[model samples]
Target: MTQYIGRFAPSPSGPLHFGSLMAALGSYFQAKSQQGQWLVRVEDLDPPREQLGAADSILRTLENYQLHWDGNVVYQSHRHDLYQTQIEQWLSSGEAYYCQCTRKQIKAMGGFYNGHCKPLNHQDPAGCAVRLHIDQPVTEFTDLKHGQITLPQALAEEDFIIKRRDGLYAYNLAVVLDDIDQGVTEVVRGADLIEPTGRQMSLYHQLKQPTVSYLHLPLALDENGNKLSKQNHAPAIDELDTQATLLRAMDCLGFAIEPSLKDGTIEEIIQWGVQHWSISQLPESTEITPRFSNGSV
Candidate 1:
């Protein structure tokens, strides 16, 4: 049997919150349950949004919770050359083209790119963003938790940007390339990214790379049904109370913890969690209210 490999890639825009913990614990438990390798990748692609010390703080938070990874953490910022190499290959092969359309122009065209720049054959790649001319559309993929997911045909056919005009690699391009390069067999992340699955799968086909399995866990939402994220000002997890935080995160994942394990160490809790981890047992809803200690709910 082929060994399983999973990863948890998080942006270092802010400190780790309950939602982030849920994704970390979910991916960690899923990988460890199968005795597979679990790796962490710091997705610091967009430097403008990254906090001063959020990357180090996130690593420290993971360590405090005993969610140790299998290898040294991978950072996307140091991988511009790798991404650029693939971009150049696609451009040379006519698989991708340069785009000069601004966001405001696309919004004016009913919020979807109309492939305005595909016919231009723009040669100046310095200021223009690169877009993949998607000939084959990825309509559907079976998610482990959500089963068959069919994306809108228009969305599947739209030419998406691979590199931004700001000279930064787009998330879709970088993530797909990284996953392929890292040999990741399975991707376990939050359901908020479900919409991007089809695009990434399409990229896999375009690059002639095998698509990885996907299992998007339910998102942690606040009282107003907003996702718990740095943009929403979600409080960071308290490392000092790792035990409680872990238990709460497990509970959010629909794991029924025994009262006896209330006082267990992080290791003990993780061992128990791996033993009982079940993707099929996860909540069916995509959004779930996370129970926090500060009575924020």
Candidate 2:
């Protein structure tokens, strides 16, 4: 029998926040309930957004909360060679092409990109990016949480870049490759990334790799409707009140709260939660953002 496998891949932009814990808990319970392996991965490919020691802080916080992970953690920052190999393989196979078209060129044509560089023998300088060719629709899949979702045509079928113009790999390319590398059987992440579901599915097809299950959890937003993130200055998770924080996160994910267990330890609360965990128990619609009026940064 195939064991269920899931991952919580956090970017090292800042210390793990309340919203981050919700995602980690959802993935953890989903994996643990099925006796599956749950892994932690750091998506630190984008250096500009990464914070110093942020990954270590996140891992320490998770451990303190008793959200233990299986095996060793994987960091995308160390996987550049794998990404390059795949890029080369696709290029040799005519599945990818070098693109020289500017963003303005794409907009002038339409909001969508036409395969302008797919058949070109043009000189693309150091800043050139490699793009994938897609002449057919990438199609749709039913989301475990949000039901049937058909992606935007431009995104699903457009000639999207695999490598960045700055010689870096794009997030879409890196994530698909990393998921494949880690043998991640399922993904549980924020609803904000639901749009990329179809694109990721398309990559699976291109590589002839098996598709993985996905669950996009609702994003935590501020009062202004902005997603709680480093940019929005969302507060870091408080280690002092870990159980309280975890319970609050579970509530945000629609898990039933036990008033009697209010002052319990993290392990005790997690034990109760894992035993009662059920995907059917989670809310299908987007949930309200969990916020503290006292404020934090």
Q: Please give the TM-score that candidate 2 achieves against the real structure.
A: 0.94
Tens digits of per-residue lDDT, candidate 2, 137-189, equal 56688778777787877778887888988888888889999988888899988
Please tell me which predicted candidate would have the highest TM-score against the true structure. Answer: 1
Instruction: Specify the poorest-scoring 10-residue window by lDDT in model 1.
Output: 288-297
Q: Candidate 2, which ten residues in sequence have the lowest lDDT sum?
A: 288-297
Summed backbone clashes in each candidate are 0, 0
- For model 2, state the Cα shift of residue 74 in Å: 0.7
| Alpha carbon lDDT of each predicted model | 0.91, 0.83
| TM-score, structure 1 vs. true | 0.97
